[model samples]
Target: MAELYSKARTKWACRRGMLELDILLEPFVDEAYDQLSEQDKLVFQRLLEVEDPDLFAWFMGHEACPYPELDAMVKFVLDRVRA
Candidate 1:
């Protein structure tokens, strides 16, 4: 199904090398993406364009991401996980 393929693509993209990143991203992609606004979805994909080390730092709270859109998306994902 087309829907499954879309999810597969998202899953593959979410597979950042770090296990910690994977753990945070995978479930969020599966469970929360569909509920996101179009702007938020774009923000999430933009977040994926970031390097793995940067993602690790941002997602782990070592530092805030420099991009406002990316930071908001990261926060959205983190909030979904915490909730």
Candidate 2:
């Protein structure tokens, strides 16, 4: 499947206004995004569309993501970095 966004564009989108989000997302795009399956990449992109506050909350374990696909992708990103 063709990518929905270029790596450069995706990396740019990963740059949130919050530093903590920027720290988590930018490196994930650089380090692990290329290794993801096409479907998973799409999921990640969808996750990026969510608001920064929501992303921050989910990543910080303060709130659960309501969407299952997004939640899974969030967990995947968190697990990858935590590992």
Candidate 3:
């Protein structure tokens, strides 16, 4: 996956705004995934890949994230990173 990511570097590097943050987050995601369940891993994968308006909502807990697949991960990542 790293090689694929490397090949896609140009595309990812050109991503705008917070999406660029996701590119910086790849390493942390790898470290964190070691402790996650298979189901949660799938959720994490989707959370990293998808761009939804509510994607970061659950992180703040100011609004509820309706996407069942990513809500737990959004919360978990927020708790882990504290931001």
lDDT of 2 by residue, 1-83 (tens): 46476798899999889999999998899899999988888999899999999999999999999999999999999888877
**Per-model TM against the reference:** 0.88, 0.93, 0.54
Compared with the true structure, the alpha-carbon lDDT of candidate 1 equals 0.84
Candidate 1 has which clashing residue pairs, if any? none
After TM-score superposition, the amount by which residue 69's alpha carbon in candidate 3 deviates from its true location, in angstroms, is: 3.3
Shift in Å, residue 8, candidate 2 = 0.6
Q: Tell me the spans in candidate 2 whose CA falls farther than 4 Å from its real position.
A: 1-3
| lDDT, candidate 3, 1-83, per-residue tens | 43333314523432535653454345445456566766675566556565543444445466877786677666677666544
Q: How many Å off is the CA of 30 in candidate 3?
A: 4.3
lDDT of 2 at 35: 95
- Overall lDDT per candidate, in order of appearance: 0.84, 0.91, 0.54
Using lDDT, give the best candidate's number: 2
Candidate 1 to native Cα RMSD, angstroms: 2.9
Candidate 1 segments exceeding 4 Å error: 1-5
